[model samples]
Target chain A: MLIWNRAKILYIKKINWHLCLIFAAISSQPILTSMTWKQVFSSSIGRKLTMGLTGIFLITFLIVHMGINACMWAAVYFKDDHGEMFNKAANFMGSMVVIRIIEFGLFFFIFLHIIQGYMLTVYNRSKRAVGYAVDYGSKGSKWYSRSMGLLGTLILLFLIIHWLHFWIPSRFTGVEEVEYNGVKMHNMFALMQTTFQQLWVVILYVLGCISLGYHLAHGFQSAFKTIGVHNKRYQTMLTGLGYAFAIVVPFVFAMMPITMYLGWVK
Target chain B: MEHYNMSLHLKVWRQNNSRDKGHFENYKVDGISSEMSFLEMFDVLNERLITEGKEPIAFDHDCREGICGMCSMYINGKPHGPWKSNTVCQLHMRAYKDGDTIVVEPWRANAFPVIKDLMVDRSAFDRIVQAGGYISVNTGNAVDGNSLPIEKDKADASFAAAMCIGCGACVAACKNSSAMLFLSAKVAHLALLPQGEPERKKRVVSMVAQMDKEGFGACTNTGACEATCPKDISLSNIARLNQEYLIASLTADK
Candidate 1:
């Protein structure tokens, strides 16, 4: 009788564990999916608060990503090494377990962001499908806000190619080697330079960066509002921050190729 | 200063009532003032119509100033008559000259039902507002603005959102016809204030439900609202609304 009771208890425990795991996974969906519109934009302040926070988070991610990629520009400029420094930098980035963990985090953030965006767009579409009587509104809304889905899709496509070319093959797949400066190096720098030198690759990079800029221009201020930071006194400052982020990060990213194309580096 | 006495053509929409079948009526207006407001030019045409023993075309207008948001018209492929940041009533005729053909139409949205020629019933916005758009400030709990001592920045943001005049321009300009901008303004205003704290989650829940119930289109972040809004309300408001919706949903206690 005692043995039978123990076996039953064990079975219940295993079942409970499986159920907990399933629930945990389900609970992590973007919180807005189940919310009412009132909850989404209940008040002007609430609306601004939410948007501001999300925008800032997205902008931060872009800046970090751009900074890491700037190493390519550095590699081109440092000619005597002829790719030695870049190769080391690439290897260092690949070898860092910390960077890998961050990369995973970035992947998660981006995936959730796109999913939430899609859901909002879908819900907005359904609601508008009913009947809208407002004769004149939205005359001042910017194009970036209007075409987020299209731009987001384009960025997503860029991300996929970006991963395949730089992340997936370079890190997950085996590293390729090339000889330079009488020394064999993990051809990561060579790969980067060659990729940038190609017209198509440069064009794609430029397009992606521009899209990122457009996204950030509105996104930064929106994120601040999301966290309840909307106020008149800081409005100009917040907008300035957005512009600064949008312009600087994309400009730096673009300069990498522009510089390379100009033959500023060997 | 460009001067040209423009003989212009117009295909204006005319309807007697919501149940009436609306049709296009053509008219020509000559010697229009280059500096005249778009509505003023319309007044000139209406005077001629009245003189001709015809009932002048009925339209809706409240504050000629852009603040009231009552004047709304779709001009030849653009909302609020082509000039950015100018409401239909504020749009100057100088924008067009020398025999330009214009098509004038009422703001078209599911929520807005046409009541007369170029006059739409935007009461759906009122319905959405009544559905929990206001802050649940308890009676006699008058809190001084300085009592909470909110950060100046938050206060400024709240003021900006509070500037929304409930105009339906965003819907007319939007391809999806989303009211996200309007909804965002309402949401952002209260969310920034401390008095709006206790029932924040419930407020958003009810208001958003009401907006959806009214048949307003979803916000796709196209920003046509910001471009055409006489107030130039920012698209950041919509993004903030999305974040609030997410947080409220996640943090709500069942």
Candidate 2:
């Protein structure tokens, strides 16, 4: 054990792992070291890996949030006193500890996702600064795929507004409502109905959902491919799945707002 | 492949450099064999031109076997000619018939500076690779390959990446002149293995830095690289590269 310790000390002393750690830490930091454009757009997997993981996580969050929102639909459709249910659910969730935890998680996920995405876009743009002389004619490719960064920025903006308007009030505002059966409900239906009724809000939500759909169309299959699921058996099916998710999620989510506007869901 | 006669008109692009304007020069060749490989047919044309005491048309080629990946030229507006799994040299005259007016030109990209005629300097790619493309394995280490039991699927995936010849055909084929396919191959090769984990973040960051310096375009996910590749490298590789880069940029040591 003594000899091993000595060897380890020698190894550390020789290679200076601490220095490497510092360098790596500095390089990895978003503020300290921004990636060059080549690094961002250099590899197929690199690009997809970034886009895919963030997309999966973001989409997962969206689905969960949408599911929660869909509870309002349940209340509206079932003809129950869902106002009470909403109050109970919101009060239970509004507990100090739970709200804090949820807030931290949301912040961490969104911040990391956006920071990475921004760096990648910057790298991509910078790398292609010089123009090509000859036209190789690889055009007629999909449009949405190329415009991910722009679409992502739009989504980010939506996320910021969403969190500011909804998440913040629900969490840090210290507001109270009701609790039932160990669940908190915050008159969310009323909040949503009133908020979503505004013309600009509805328009923005529609646009955001569309952008999310477009983002998912490329991002879904891209994630599958990133996780190394690229056999003939899965490729076509996976691609089909991407299209389905991209189209279905937005369509379903958008339906709620449209229905709300059309008075279909009360 | 059996020899057959083919009479074709060749419209080849001639350019001195980025500063010079380029145009097409046409040549008529008769009694060609469809069985002859595309490069071999060029050889025949060059021979005819040499005998006629004219400057032979210039093009690029290194390994005729398609392994070295040095040859890259757009034939009739298609990168690496019309074959699915072929390089410019591996392309056969059989892809065309008699009297076909084939147009040939070098890949156009500001990143890929031209040397002369159909030969463009692709050393920009070399710089990208040198800038943290490899796994940073020290020489004389003599590590056993099996010492690290990589998953079979991962091994196969790495093998696919290892097949990239750095031909720049992917960039040439891209409308955006994107090197996403090329960079993706390198990233996929390293990212699939455990040995590559140690330097993964640095590798991605540096390689991308080098790629940007080289002036390659962003990937639009058009997948032209897969279409034009002589080795049939996948666009999925590009996706993989993007994911790795994102992860690295997001959650690096910091």
lDDT values, one for every candidate:
0.69, 0.71
Deviation (Å) of B160 in candidate 2:
4.4
| Candidate number achieving the greatest DockQ relative to the actual structure | 2
Interface CA root-mean-square deviation for model 2: 7.2
lDDT of 2 by residue, A1-266 (tens): 44334434544575653333333333322222455445444453355455556667777776666665565566565676555544554444555686558757766766766776677666555543333334445342466766677888888887677777677776667334445567545655566667778878878878888988998887777666665564667878988988988998888887767767766555
Q: TM-score of the B chain in model 2? A: 0.95
TM-score of chain A considered alone, across all candidate predictions:
0.71, 0.71
| DockQ scores for all predicted structures | 0.14, 0.18
lDDT of 1 by residue, A170-205 (tens): 756756797755755577765666767788887887
List model 2 lDDT by residue over B1-254, tens digit each: 56679899988877876677777789999888888888898889999999999778778898798888888888766778878778888888888888888888887777877788888888787656645555544445678877879889889989988799988888877655778789889878988888788768777777776775577755656566787787778787775676576677667554
